[model samples]
Target: MTTSDVMQDVLGVILGGGQGTRLYPLTQKRSKPAVPLAGKYRLIDIPISNCLNAGIEKIAILTQFNSVSLHRHIYRTYRRDMFTEGWVEILAAQQTLQGNLWYQGTADAVRQQLTEIQRSNAKYVLILAGDHLYQMDYREFVRYHIETEADITLAVQPVEAKLAAGLGIVKRNSDGQIVEFCEKPDLDALDELESMPDSDKPFMASMGIYVFSMEMLAELLASPGNDFGKDIITGVLSERRVMGYVFDGYWADIGTIRRFYEANLEMVSPTRPFDLNNARRPIYTHPRFLPPCEVYGAKLDQVLLTDGCRIYDAEITNAVIGLRSIIGSKVVIKDSVIMGADYYESEEDRTKNRQLGRPDVGIGEGSVIAGALIDKNARIGKRVQIRNLSDRPDETHQNWAARDGLIVVPKSAAIPDETVI
Candidate 1:
C-alpha cells in the first residue's frame, strides 16, 4: 500500500483512562497521560507524536480520570489547522441513556467508544497506551500486520529473564505467529513461555500495542470483556490468526514511581537509548512561548533545563529542570526531576502568597532536594530538606510523600521552611 493508502486505512486509538494508582501524587491532579515528562513534554505526547510522525492523523484519545488537563493539552497542542482531513480527538467516558457505566479496562474503554470508532472510515485500528515512553514508526508496524495478513498483531519487545514475569509473555513461532500468551506469569510459567533461544533476552513481552482489522476488533468487542491482555487476547488466540511484531527499541512503561523516576533520569544520560532530540520525529507538546532559561552562578552537570527557568547560585547534577522553574540561591538538587511551574508567578501573586504566609512558586534558598520528583508549581521554602533518608518504600506527610525511597512533592504543594523528610 502507498503511504497515503496506509494513512487513510489506519485509525489510531490511544487509551488514556487508567487511574494511575502507582504514580499517585503526580496523578493526584492530572491523569497519567497528563503527567509531565523529560522536563517538558507530557506522557501522552509520545504516542500522539508517533502516530503523527507515521502519518496516522485521525486519532482518538480515550480519557476518564482527571482528564481536564489532558483535554487542555490535547486541544492546545494538536491544532486542526496543521493537517488536511486530519484530527486528534478525545473520547471521554460519559453516561448515556443506554448505560451509565465507566471504563472498566483497556478493551472496555474502546468498547464504550465503539460507535465513534466505527464512524471512522478506516480498515484497521491501532490501539496504543498513553503513558509509555518510546518512539515507534506505526507505519512499519501496520505494514507488517498487512504483510502477515493477521486479524490481530501485538507489538512485543524482548526483555531480560528477570523482567519477563511482570509482563504478558507471548510465544510465537518463526513466522511471527503467536502460539501462546500469559499476562503477569510466575517464574515457572515464564520459563515455559520463553520464545527466544540464543539471545540473552529470551522472553517476548507484550508492549500493550496492537493493530487489528476493524472487523475483527469490532467482533471481539462484541463479547463481554474488560481488558485486552486478560480477556480478548487470551480468548482469541485459539480462533484468530494472531501475530507478533518484535520492537527492538527503547521502550519503558512508566507505570510505577520507581520506573517513572528512573525514566526521567535516563533522559539526562549521555548515552541513552531513547533520544528526544531526533529532528526527524520530534515529540510535540503544548507550546509555551516563555523566555530562555537563565542560569546565574549555578554549578550544573548533565542537566536538562527547559524554557523559562531561573537558577541562581545553586548546585545541580543529573537533574531535569522543567519549564518555568525558579531555583533560589544556595540550593542543592541532585538526581531529581523538578516538573517546574505551570506559569510564572507575577510580583502581585508573590506578594499575595507572602501575605497568606506561603512561599513563592518554586524551590527556595538553601533547600536540599535529592532523589526526588517535585511536581508542577510546588513551593519549597528556605532550608527545606526532602531526601528519603530511611529508604522507606512508602510514606505520606502533609503535602509531600515518599515512594520507593524517592521524595515526591505533589503539584502546588507547599513545604514550610527548614522542614525535613
Candidate 2:
C-alpha cells in the first residue's frame, strides 16, 4: 500500500509519561522524552519524526511527571500551520471527578487519554515509546499489520540471547502469528520461548512499538490493566489475533544511564546502525540560529560536535558534544556524552558568575572526563577528574552519580577543582 493509504486512518500516540528512574539526573529535571539525545535532538523526536515521515500527522503525546519541559518543547517545536489538518498535541495527566490518579503504566497512560485519542476518527492507533532510539518507517509496519489482519501488531526485533532477558519476548510460529509473549523472562522461561527452527537469532524481543485496531484497543483498555507488556499484550494473547513484525535495525531503549550513554557514544562511531544524516527522513527539532562550533588546536576523532561549541586545546575522542559547550585548554575528554550548555554566558554573565563565586558553564582547564555523561550547563572546575575508578554499578555522590560504570554529572551541577569521581 502507498504511504498515504496506510496513514489515512492511523492516529499516532506517543507515551511520554514514564519517570525514567534509570536515566536519573538527566530525567531528574526533564521527562524521559524531553531528555537531550545525540547532541541535538530529544528522545521524543524519534517516534514523532517517524510518524510524521510516515505521513501520519495527527499525533498525541501523553506526559505526566515533570512534563513542564516536555510541554514547552512540544509547544515550541511542533506548531502546525493553519492550512494543514495535521497537529501534534500533548495529553497530560489530570485529576477529575472520575478519578484522581497518575499514569499507572504505558497502557494506563493511553487509557486515561482515550477521550482525545477517540476524537481522531482513526481506525488504527500507532503506539510508541518516547524513550527509544531508532528510525523506522511506520508505513511499512502499518501495512504489515493490515495485511496480516491482526488485531494487534507488535514491532519485534531479533536480539541476542544475553540481552533478551530484559525485554518482552514474543514467540511466533512460521506464519508470524504470536503464540506466546513474556515480559522480562527468567532463564527457564527464556529457554521455552527460544526462536523456532533454532537459527542464530534465538530471541525475538518486542521493540515497545505497537499498532492496534482502535476498536480492539478501546475494548482492552476498558478492563483493569495499566501496562502493555505486563498486562495487555500478555492478557490478550490467548483470545486475540496478535502478530509480530520482525524489525532488523538498531533500536536501543535509552531508559537507563548506561544505555543512554552507550547509545550517544555509538552515534559518533565510524559505522553506526542509527543514521541521523538521512535527508529523506530527517529528525526534526527546535531550530536554533546559533553560530558554528569553534575548535582550536583540538585533537578530535570520531566526534559529533553540535553547533555553538568552543573547544580550545582539548583532546576529544569518541564523544558526542552538544550545543554551546565550552571546553578549556589541556582538557582531555574520551568516551563521553557532553550535553552542552543551554545558553552561552556573555561577558556580563561571566563577570557576575565570577563575582558570585560560580564557575563558568562547561569543562575547566586540565580536567579529565572519560566514560561520563556531562549534563547541560555543568561547571567543572580546573583539574577535576571524573573517570569512574571504582567501576561501581550504581552510586550517588554530591551533584554526580555513577551507574553501570558510567559517571553522570547532572544538569547545572558544579564540580570543584581537584575533585575525582
Candidate 3:
C-alpha cells in the first residue's frame, strides 16, 4: 500500500491509569495526568492537544486511580457533546471476569473497554501514555502504519544509550522495520549495542505511542498476558511485521517529579523544547472565569501566571502560578509547579481552599525559595529559608524534607507568622 492509499479511520486512546507513584506528593492528591502543567493546563492536555492538532477527534481517556481530577478536567475543558462529528469519553474501570480489582496492566485496561472501541467503528487504534509531554502529528504515524500495511506500528526516537536502557529498546532493520524489541536490557548489552556504530542503524527507542490494527489489538487483548510491552508486544515483535516510525520531535515523558520541574522550566527558556505557538490547531483546556493575573510588588521575569493570581512582594522566576493563587509579601517561588485549588479541593469548599493559597512554610517576611515545589493553601511564616542544592543526579524522584533543605508543606497546613519552617 502507498502512503496516499493508507487506511485512515484511527481512534486515539490514552492510558491514564498509572498511580504515578514516582511523582510522590504531587500525585499524592491527583493522578499523573491530572497534574498541572505550564500553570494553566494539566498533563493530560498535552496528548489531547496533540490529537486535536493532528486532526484526530475521537479519543478515549482510560483512567482509574484518583480519576476525579482527570475526569473533572476533561469535563470542564473538552466539550465532546459540542462536537457534531466525533466524541471524547472517559472509560473507568469496572469489575470483570479477570478480577474485581482495577486494571491489571496497560493491555487489560484496553480489554475492559473493548465494547467502547467497537462502538467507535475505528479501523486503527492509536495507544498513548497520558503522562508524556510532547507535540506531534499522529496523522503522519497513522499514514506510515497504513502505508507499511503492518500489523502494528510504533513511534520511536533516539535517546542517550544510558537512558534508552530504561525504556523499551528497538532494533530495526535497514528498511526501518522492527527486528527485535526488548524492555530495559542490562547496561552491558546496551553498551554492546551502542559500541557498534552502524552507519544506517538508528538507536530507536519507543515513545509509548503505537498504532495497531483493530484485529491485531483485539487478538492481543484476548491473549493471556500481564503487560503489552513485556509480554504481548515483545512476543509479536519477533514474529509479525511491526514497523517503527522514526520521530525527532521534542518528547518528554514527565513521569518523575524532577523531570516535571525541568519540563516546565523549559518553557521559560529563550527557545522552548515544545512549541506552544502553533496556531493551526490550538490546545484546548477549561475556561476560567477569573480576571487577568494581577502583578503587585513582585520582580517577575519569563513566568507564566494564570488568571486571578495576585503576586505580592515576591520573586517569581521561571515558574507557573495556578489560578486565583495569592503570593504573599517577600515570598519567592522559583522553578517549580503550583497546582490550582480546584483540582485538590471539593466543590463545596473551594472558596476556602482559594483563601488558603499562600506560603505555608514559615518563611519570614524576607525569605527565599529556590528550586522548590509548594502545595496549595500552605502558609509560610516569615524568614523561612528553603533552598537545598543537594540533589542526586541519577535519581529523578525525591521527597521534600527539611534535612534535604527542601521543606514541603502540605495543602491547607497553617504556619504562624515569623516562625521558621
Candidate 4:
C-alpha cells in the first residue's frame, strides 16, 4: 500500500497509564501524560502532535490513574472539524460485563480498550507512550511497517550501558530483525543484549513506540500476560516477524524527577537538541489566548519564557518559566522549572491570600530557587530559599520534597516566609 493510504488507515493508540510514582508530586494530581512539558505543553502533546502531523487523524488515548486533568486537557485541546474524519478521543478505564478492575499493565490497558479502538476500522495501530518527549513523523513508520510485511515493528534507539538496565533492551540482527528482547535486565545479562557491541551506545533500547497489524495486535492481546515489553514482545519474538526500526533522534523518557528536570533544562541551553518550533510540525496545546509575556529589567540567560508571564527585576538563568509565572524583584532562579500558575491571580485573589496568611501564587520576593521544580499554582513566600542546600537525597515535607538532588514543590502548595531547604 502507498504511504498516504497506510497513514490514512492508521489509528494512534497512546498508552497513558501507570501510577508514574517515579515522577512523584507532579504525577500525584495528574497522570504521566498530563505532566507539564516545555513550560507550555503537556507530555501527551508530543505524541498527539506527531500523529496529527503525520496525517494519522484517528487517535485514542488510553488514560488511567488520576486522569481527570488529562481528560479535560484533551477535551479542550483536540477537536475534529466538520470537514475531516479525523478525531482524537480518550478511552478511560470503565467497568464492563467482563470484569471491573483497573488497568493491569500496558498490554492489558490496550486490550481493555480494543473494542473502542477497533471501531476506527484501522489496518494498523500505532502504539505510543504518551509521556515521552520526541518528534517523529509516524507516516514513515506505518509505511515501513507495511513494506516490511512484519507482524510487529518497534522503534528502537541506541543507549549506553547505564541507561540500558532501566529500559527494555533489544538485540537486532544486521538486517534490523529484533532477535531477542529483555526488559530491564541486570548487569550479568547486559552483554548478550548488545546490538552494536563496538559502538559507544551498544544496546538498542526500545522506545516503547510500536506498530502492530490490527489482527496481530488482537491475537496477541487475547493471550495472557500484561506488559508489551515484558510479555508480548518477547513472547512472539521467535514465532512472529518482529522488526526493529532504529531512530537516531532526540528522544527522552521523562518518567523520573531527574529526567524530567534535565529534559526541561536542556531546552534552556544555547544549542537546543529538541527544537519545538517547526512550522510544518508544531507542538500543539490548549490555545489559552493569554496575553504576551512581560518582563521588567530582568537579567535573563538561557531561559524559556512562555505566555502570560510577568517578571520583575530577577536574575534567572537556565530555567523554564511557564505560563502566567510571576517572578518578583530580587528573585534569583537558576537551573529550575517553574511551571507557573494555572490561572493568573487577580488583585482580589491576592487580597484573599494575604488575609489567609498565604503567599500569592508564584516565586515570592527576595527568594532564591535553584535546582528545583515549582509546580503549577505553588505559593512561595518572601525570602524563601529552595536550593536544597542540605543536599538530601530524598526527603518529603508537607508541601515540598527533595528528590533526585532537586527540590520539588507540589501544585498549589503554600510555603511560608523565611523557609529554607
Candidate number with greatest lDDT: 1
Tens-place lDDT per residue, model 4, 237-325, is 99999999888889999889999999999988878889877799999899998999889999999999999999999999999999999
lDDT of each: 0.92, 0.89, 0.73, 0.91
How many clashes in each candidate? 0, 0, 17, 0
Better of 2 and 4 by TM-score: 4
Across 1-421, the per-residue lDDT of candidate 1 in tens digits comes to: 5966887889999999578989998999899999999989999999999998999979999999999999999999998884488889999999998679989999999999999998997888999999999999898899999988999999999999889888899998899999999998988777778788888998899999999988999999999899998899999899999999999999999999989999999989989778988999999999888998899999999998899999999999999999999999999999999999989899999999989989999999999999899999999999999886544868787799888888999999999898887
Name the candidate, 2 or 4, with the larger lDDT value: 4
| TM values, all candidates | 0.98, 0.97, 0.87, 0.98
Write candidate 3's Cα lDDT for 1-421 as tens digits: 5432332367889999578877766777788898878767888998898887776778899999988978988987888665356678999987877568788888888888888887888888999999998888787889888788888888988777658777888877767788777788787777444322553333678888889988889988888886777777888876788898988888898877677777888876768977766797576788877767777778988786777776678887887776666666877777655544543234545456346643332233666667666666555556666554655232232323332334444454555444443
Model 2: lDDT of residue 13: 96
Q: How far out, in Å, is residue 22 in model 3?
A: 0.5
Give per-residue lDDT, candidate 4, residue 76: 93
Ranking by lDDT: 1, 4, 2, 3
Per-residue lDDT of 177-278 in model 2, one digit per residue for the tens?
888998899988887887653677788998889999899999999998889988998998899889999889889988778788888988898798899899
**Superior by TM-score: candidate 1 or candidate 3:** 1
